[model samples]
Target: MRTRPVLKATEPWEKLVWWPKVMYEEGRYRLWYEAVPPDHWDPEIGPKLAWPNPVFAGLLCYAESEDGFTWTKPELGIGSWDGSNETNISLGRETVGPMGLHGASPFMDPDAPPEARYKMFWYGDATPDVVKAARRERPDAIDPRTTDESHVRAMYVGTSPDGLNWIVQDKPAVVFSSDTLQVVEWDALRKQYVWYGRGWSWGRRTITRAETTDFSRWPLPQDVLTASPINPEQTDLYTNGKTRYPGDPTTHLMFPTLYDRATDQTTIGMATSVDGVAWNWTPGNPVLPVGSPEGVDAGSMFVGIGLVPLPGDRIGLPYAGYSYPHKFPANLADSGFSWCTWTRGRLAGVHAQTEGEFRTPPVRLAGSGLRVNCRVQSGGSLRVGVTDEEWSEIPGLGVSDCQPITGDQLDATVRWSGGSKLPVDRAVSLHFSLRTASVFGFEILDER
Candidate 1:
């Protein structure tokens, strides 16, 4: 899906803006992004502060919008810049102390008290004691050159009554440097806090996972998704843009940015998992490819951390776009924020050109009716049937009894001439037949 640019770099402090974390709450959309000041990369002064160290590079800023399309950066007078507290900066060198803010992932804690309603996990410099302990425990994980005052980094936790102001903890949450956006979510089903971030495997960057019952203490991460032999030879997974489908907890989705070392470019790919840990790449990789050579996002792009549900039954995925290669000089790169959308529940589909049929594994019926998300071309049609565990067609629920679905609909009820009602207490399987049609997904509906 191609993106439509919505936010751009306008303020002097926002010479380069990216890494967006968007949330929808209280009928308003809030966005937190990484904004880099020009001085951070200026040759004369950049070297003085060890600028561009992956962990201590940018400022965390805020923006908002009534609708997801248009956004506004409000001046909160929170973080002072150029001797004035007139910018929308939320966390910077002054607020976050010496570590500074690099990549911030903020989420609403449903289980927390009002005072700690909002929580954030960010990457920043590690204190001397924390760095020393990490090196002593896990020597291979810590970078060799990292010292007490230098490139040593770790993940930190903070809380906020509101989304703007924050209270950071004194110690680091995880001692290893994930060097990318660290995503954390409260898994209500598992009743634990789940984290996804960067890890190394086969000498390349890969997505890692960790879980804990307590949010304050996190274990060392383990690589969960890595570059497989099927991927291109010189490619690696850079960032894990992990999110769960709205209104559904069974499906976990990720849009990881694939970095191509040969061309020094990056693109987005799609993956899905049932339990958030074991993931499989969806067919037709590079779901969101870069634009033409002269286009604004030709060089590289990184999808953000959330999948927002917009009006008109659409899903918007936020991203950052750049006009220069991933390794291009920061001083000359052009970057901004934008979003791409897909039809609600249509991120992946099973298609048939001439004719095709497939049967789902046995599932216990929990609802009364079946509703499908599909599109049938002019000369095509789709039908659904029910089968027992032994692959025998159930009476009154065979394909021949089903009314042919002939039009595109986001949620079309599957009907059968015999009856639309289904048995809810027995195990059954669904069989789908299509001709020149595509089926995105199906849901068991409870008519009661």
Candidate 2:
């Protein structure tokens, strides 16, 4: 918790580097994000809410990276910003209304059609006359923020062959009130299209989830991951950075940016799920905290869409950092992207003050040995035992016979008297006992 990510990128014209989602495809990494202008204001007129600034309200730009660390933006000359086709824009403002497109989430579907291989889900602002008429008819009778009138702020889908060119669906697929980041990802493990976006509850931010076999139709959104029961009632969570846990399909890892409206500070916190619909919000710690009290990210720190495994046993997570309160000043380009890392499997762990034990659910062993991701302190150690169906420890595989394991290792193998001789066909359980250590995860090592 409270891990740090280094500043990764910035753009001269990108005043507010908004929601960024990254996808791995074409043998490289592609980052799709929204860019806003430096001068942010809430105009009295609804039409001018986005200020007609092409780069501010509706600029979607693309960037590429080789290692998920260093990034480069290619000038596509696709959009006419400030007069001519002279920006690194992906979706041109000429094709759509200003600030119409936001929160662009690119997804690579293996089971998708060839022509429409790459797809995106984003907010398309279309001020409908029905809602407008109702507001005019009875201004005092409605609260637009909570009313279905705001549903005109809809979510639309677009397909692209190369993540650049696109064909947007003519009509809004699912209409909902959206302002913050919305994510759409293909859950390969579950074979479903997962949609996580913003919904209002008690005038604060809340996350709602919906699943569909087809992107065109989604059922009513249900509240899933939000502020835990223990958190202060006013604390808000934005952009549940949900991703499939590496090496384990049964677990989903999420790092939601927890924002405290009182302090205006944002940090990434951990929440876990066995099924994407239900979540267990980690209490009292952040997977990554906001920047320093006087630092660039002091105000907000929203983790980006992708999580990459980097060299030297590190995990790369991109995040956008910005100062708090959103007041504009001379330095409007202070907000940008940052890449952070962690020791493998350190996102969540069971800590032992002096000694503790935990037994994992039964698992079939298809490999020769077992490996564990854990860290052992200098004055402490860890030992793991295998149990049978009856919860009985096998001879030479009991805690007393285990080799005392030490060190911070991502894949430290468990050794017994006879290596690679554990029973393979039966469902066995791993019982771990440790002293002053943190056990992250375990895996059955295949015989080479």
Candidate 3:
């Protein structure tokens, strides 16, 4: 992993920043993240903030870039904070206050009406009045270890035409028995809105999921992904950094922060799902490990809610970094946001020490041409063949006819003697052979 973060909390009042969600649209990159100022509480409530409470909670802020790498936080002036309207505040204070801003997970919908093209799923409005009433109804409503649980911690929806300016929906979207990180995304493959957040199960902080055809009517969330039995007794999945795999819409990827409360350290783990509901956790260890002891992000490190595109056909994960005692107490000075990336199409790929091969599940293609991302060592080679469900290689596209792939590339097209088109219209699988090479992944090009 690269050593430094792409973004930092450099402003004087900037207490800490976390949970960044990014989107690339119309040739520009839009970033919506949760930023908390040292003095976030209202003046009336300032003196009452005796505990290690967030004086002024988080305010969802905005930043833009022609390229996703270089970001600029333009002063929107739409929200006021700490007696100043000088921050890049998108929605908070005077705009959508009483709760201020929390987790504003934004997504652009070309299919939505113009006024609602961009939408955000957020948490907050956990005001005293709301909290008191909620606590009366349910005594263990909030986690007292962090903040007051009485805050109405329901999920709310907001829409924007240009992503900066906003219109919060009048009604709340989803209500939870407790407060946790909420993330929402448009599931084009399923043609529904999928929501992932904190869910309690087996007496631990497990992950749960729900789907909604309409934004308002959601079925009760069910436990989808959870900590593995092999994990330590205190293992918990913190937040879901879920995003649709760009090339394969049918698959979903998530960076789940594995919380070991017993040890008090957090690391990022990888989870995959064909549908957004059930997940398959990658085994062994963290895909994105936490930093060293006493290092930034050593205490806790959660990945970006949105996975942006990067060069070399890779995916960029912009993450927020935090030091030890990963709490809101004492205001850890170095807490900020940073970034890391995974090779495209291969966040999880099989490795071949010397010579090995793997066969893909059957697929019927829109286009027969195959493109792959693979790395072959100097004396290594890679080959592909079309195979029947019974593992029999078809003619022309057989391994012997493959043009030996001898270089490292993200989009190297796999070819055979007769150009590698499927012989029959029925389903077929791909059999790959590698000698000192790693085949990341392959895609059947869409017919243009």
Candidate 4:
């Protein structure tokens, strides 16, 4: 048996930072992480500042390293569209909107019409009410840990002709609200502009995919990755936010979220996708585990969206380090810091030998109640065909959502089928077909 590799947290960086983004640029690695003062960032209420808690805003810090391993914090100065902080907003720059600015995802356009080569999209609110709400909510009025949604923010975009000069767009790019961990990439293989972000639902998060011919406008939303709540093996696969790995489908690697329930620790994990949307987990999906159990980063760490590739082709990731005491007083917020990590070599991928096998049950008699359970092992849409004694596809039964649950154990139940309220009990085979899971064939279960 192969031994479980031990990739412990090494030196040169602190832990428990929130929203770590990595990127590769100019034959070197650059990282951007979010950090606030430890005492100011109330753990009970998270990065969001509660009432009278003395909340300090978030900042985008810069760090550069020769090797991806060791990093040196450099001065990029405060937020700037240009090298100078003239056009940028300062700390505590509050807008009357949802929430204040958080970490931003950076994208470089080498072929950007010779005008602008860099763009950044971030989560924030320009609404006045949100800004007021941010100031109103306090530990003095209510419990700091309460979940309040009075102030919701939208995702906004900014552009830079060079890394130094940036200009915030007059209008927002996406209208949805939630703290965003975004990755903007131009895929040469698919020739599409891919934006990866997570949609919050069901006390968890799911990966959402949207494509655009141009970066200016986006179409309707679709679920590229759904949340797998009941699956224990997939417990760590929480947020589907950013992907820092370089390369297209074949060598593409992504940095995702992994929250351990055993200790309520949040950190980044690793996974890979082929077509830039659908993802498959490599062995031990939680690649970068929690920080040291007894160190500065011992609490939890979220992700940021920039990954700089270093000279030797190593990858540098900038992340925020957070420290929230498990057992703490009610009003005190969690503490946080900024740090980074670098990775080398090609990440792992999921192995599929024979694809997958899907089968729909036999036909049933008319007016008989029916429920279908088509479980898919791999992550893909499962289609079941219900024949009307003569064999035909039932309209609604053909709906997709029965995506495989990692190992394919998803069950779907439907009412009457065969164009009537009836039970299927005929000698018809249950033929299962899969779309977008993998390059494989389905199996046939002969009618009973």
Superposed model 4: Cα runs more than 4 Å off: 1-17, 37-57, 69-99, 128-150, 227-241, 244-250, 305-319, 325-346, 349-448
Task: Give the TM-scores of the predictions, in the order they appear.
Answer: 0.94, 0.87, 0.87, 0.56
The regions of model 1 sitting more than 4 angstroms off are: 52-56, 127-130, 133-150
lDDT of 2 by residue, 1-448 (tens): 2333333335554666767777665558778877764333434432455434333365678888887666788887776566766677778556655554776777777788888888888767645664465356545323344354433566678888877777877555565655567777788877889888877777778888888888765654667876877766768888777776544667777878778777666778878888788788876567677778666677777777877666567766677777663333314435667766777777778999899999977877788678889999998999988898789997878877788899988889888765635678788888899999999887776774
Clashes (N, CA, C under 3 Å) per candidate: 0, 2, 7, 54
- Model 4 TM-score? 0.56
Error of 1 at 322 (Å): 0.3
Better candidate number, 1 or 4, judged by lDDT: 1
**lDDT score for residue 13 of model 2:** 47
lDDT (CA) per prediction: 0.83, 0.71, 0.72, 0.47
lDDT of 3 by residue, 1-448 (tens): 6346667676654677777887776677778887776664546664454323553357788888876777888878776666787878888767666446565678877678998888777765544665555446544423343254443456678888888788886544544533445678787767888888777877898777778788754555677888877788888887788887764667788888888887777788888877677678876558777787666776778767777677556677777778864443526546766666777766766668899988888866677678888888999999988888787888898989999998888889877885557544777888899999987777677533
137-175 in candidate 1: lDDT tens per residue? 656545443555445678888898897898888677767
Best by TM-score: 1
Task: Using TM-score, rank the candidates from best to worst.
Answer: 1, 2, 3, 4
Over 1-448, each residue of candidate 4 has an lDDT whose tens digit, in order, gives 1011111122122112345455555556555554433334445644455323222234444555555556665434444322354322222232212133554666776667645677766666445554344336422322232244454455566666754445666455655543446667776667777777665545555666677756754443455655333335434444454554544335555666666566667666665666676776555545555566555345655555654444443444544444453323312433343334433333442223445444445544343333333333444454444444455645444423222223232123332233433224454444445544321222223322
Better of 1 and 2 by TM-score: 1
